[model samples]
Target chain A: MGMARAIEMAKEFGIGMVSIKHSNHFGMSAWLVQQAIDEGMMSLVFTNSSPALPVWGGRSKLMGVSPIACGAPAGDERPFILDMAPSIAARGKIDKAIRQGEKIPTDWALDSEGNMTDNPASALEGVMLPMGGPKGSALSIMMDVFSGVLSGSAYAGHVTNPYDPSKAADVGHFLVAIKPDLFMSLEDFKARMDYLYQRVVSCDKMGGVDRIYYPGEIEQIMRDERMKTGIPFTRGEIDALNEEAKLVGADTLNV
Target chain B: MGMARAIEMAKEFGIGMVSIKHSNHFGMSAWLVQQAIDEGMMSLVFTNSSPALPVWGGRSKLMGVSPIACGAPAGDERPFILDMAPSIAARGKIDKAIRQGEKIPTDWALDSEGNMTDNPASALEGVMLPMGGPKGSALSIMMDVFSGVLSGSAYAGHVTNPYDPSKAADVGHFLVAIKPDLFMSLEDFKARMDYLYQRVVSCDKMGGVDRIYYPGEIEQIMRDERMKTGIPFTRGEIDALNEEAKLVGADTLNV
Candidate 1:
């Protein structure tokens, strides 16, 4: 709802870098970026979540596994959506590994004393590794500052943990939208985009690789497939959704 | 020179996301962002260099190890400058290793056949690994598109290497500046920033670690130290600089 309002506001204005504060979970960052892409505007979206990773060299968890999403419309090709977590691997994946009783890769995180470890439980209690090491760590710091501190939302260790029901979540978002036609004709932009995509795809692939793909190309494929086949949510997730619907006095999912 | 003009134009136009095409090397990205920071604004600076990395799944070298610089002012403490290369390590490190006859790390790059290798020469001829693999590759793509294609500059395989004297180097840059006072009072912003910094530095350190330092904090310490002790450049770097100065008919350095 807020994202729609923000998009409308950005469209009305020549350019908008909207920041939202005191918001709850806003799903995938790419979904929000796609809003602007659909509107013929380029957008970058960012959000700060609960502390899931530690600051670069510090041991205690002082940062979220912050994510950045950048997107723009291409010609006849799928729109470009680049969404990434600054961590080497998202903490959610580590948690999933722990839940499945599987060992995580060693480079994914560090234990309490800061030594690299493959133990999912220890890594969860410690710090998740940043993408590109220090560089990714630095990018995460900036994202938190921009999305949280600058937006007057709870930042750093102050952000609310979703599992902690007593505290209110103060998640923050930083958004930017620019009119595509402002820089160049949207047609020309699209043509150039198509050319770039072709150039990339025409390159020789690494051995054993299926094919080269742009970031959101796979997502587009998935969406098309899902539109016909429907989303295959896990049974547990469906059950949880049904419970939430019952609590809200709404229709429950049959699945 | 182009950066200065872009800064001035951005200031006069209220808010500007300026792009400079056909520009040469403009020094550290932080220096450009600092220009806007000094004017009581936040800035992000990005530039596309020659190809040093490959797209995520493709084997051929097709992308630069692009860099992103983000910065904002703090209260009394040093301004926060987060500058980073979206690669595991810069190509220069590999070049240095090759020159010194040292074996490179296998994780740093892939050989021509796309297999990871510890040989610096083959890695240099091939493609360097991105900071977080796929994510970093995606970032390099966006940075190139934003800084090059959007700016009417050469992009992807079109960018010329600096060492290729026959072709004119055509680098591109993208800069964005925003007023901090837009959302909150500057004083309040500074206060929040201070609180954030304090919270980060106050964390318990990992074993064998000296202390956690913010992105620019160590650079600040080094600057203070070097101001008294003087910068110690490598012999090869000194010779190269002297030769460059001589070629340009500039006065040679005493050292």
Candidate 2:
């Protein structure tokens, strides 16, 4: 909903910045970027969540492993969509591993004792490791500054976890939409984007690598395949969704 | 010079964007961020240079290890300043290692044959690895898109190296200065920034770590020390500086 308003404002003005406070998680930042792309706009999407990673030198979690996401439209080619978390691996990946009774990579997280661990359950009790040490830690702090502090939401490890039902989560988001034709014609800007996409995908591959992909090309391909073949959902996940819908008096899953 | 104009325009219109084309390397992106901070403005500083890193899965260099920089001011605390290159280590570090006959870390770069190398000279002949694999690669690509492609400057591995001398550098920059008080009073914004600084520095320390620094704090400390004790310059560096000054008919070093 905020994205819709931001896109409308960008169409009216040359740019639009919407700082949302007291919000919940909006799944897949790429979808928000795609919303702006559908409107022929460039977008930056940032959000602050509960603490999941530690600062550079600290052990305990002090910052969210929030993703930094942005996108630009292209002409007759895949758009440039970048959505990345500051962590070495997404927290969801750890949760997925736990559900499948699998061990995660040792580099992904540290156990409660600050020792690197491969056990998914132990990893959850500990802290996610930042991608590039100080670089990733700083990026998460940047997200909190923009989304939490600036938006007057919880920050500095104060945001409540969704699983902890003691209080409101009070998440915050920073969204910006810019007109692609701000400094040049829309056509030229898109052509440049397409050219960039081509250059990125056509780069000489390393040994044992197949085709290279543009930033968001993999996601796009996955989405296309999911469209043709229905999205796979665990029976447990389907039941949970239907239960929530039933509680809200909304239509349950038809599948 | 671009920062000066950006600050002026931002003061007048609440925001300013200066996209520079066909320029040379501007040392230290943090200095540009500091310029805006000095004027009590928030800023984003981006630049594209000669390619030094490769795309995610590619063996050959295709992107510059351009820094992503930004900053905001604080009331009575150290401001928020982030300036980071996409590579694991700055290219200058490799050069310094070569000068000192020291081996770099294995993770810093790869040899000409794509094998990780500790020899600085071998790393120089090859490619600097991105910090977080695809995340860093995407960031460098983002820099090129904003600073080079959008500004009508050389991009996509076409930027000429400074030592090449075969053609103009044609470097590009994207600078944006924003009024920090756009959404609230200047006092409120600065206060928030100060709070953030305090929280970050006070994070719980991990074992073997005595201190945690906010982003750019180390640089700030170094700059302060350098101000008190004159900057150390090797005799060779002094000679090079003097030669350049003489060629330009500028003041030669007195010491």
Quote the chain B TM-score of every prediction.
0.83, 0.85
Q: Write the per-residue lDDT of candidate 1 for residues B41-86, one digit (tens) a residue.
A: 7777889888877787777778877788878788876777887777
Per-model C-alpha RMSD: 3.3, 3.6
In model 2, pairs of residues that clash are none
Judge candidate 1 at residue B159 and give its lDDT. Answer: 81
TM-score of 2: 0.88
TM-score of chain A of 1: 0.85
True contacts recovered per prediction: 0.66, 0.55
Model 2: runs farther than 4 Å from truth? A91-107, A115-124, A238-255, B91-108, B115-124, B239-255
Model 2's CAPRI class is medium
Interface RMSD of 2: 1.8
lDDT tens digits by residue: candidate 1, A1-255: 555665665566545677789987688998888888888777778888888777766667778887888887888877778888888886689889989999987767888778778899998777877776667777778888888988889987778887788978898998888666655688987777777787777666765678889878888899999999998899999999999999999999895
How would you encode candidate 2's per-residue C-alpha lDDT over A14-85 as one tens digit per residue?
666778888877788999999999999888898998998888888888898789998888999999899999
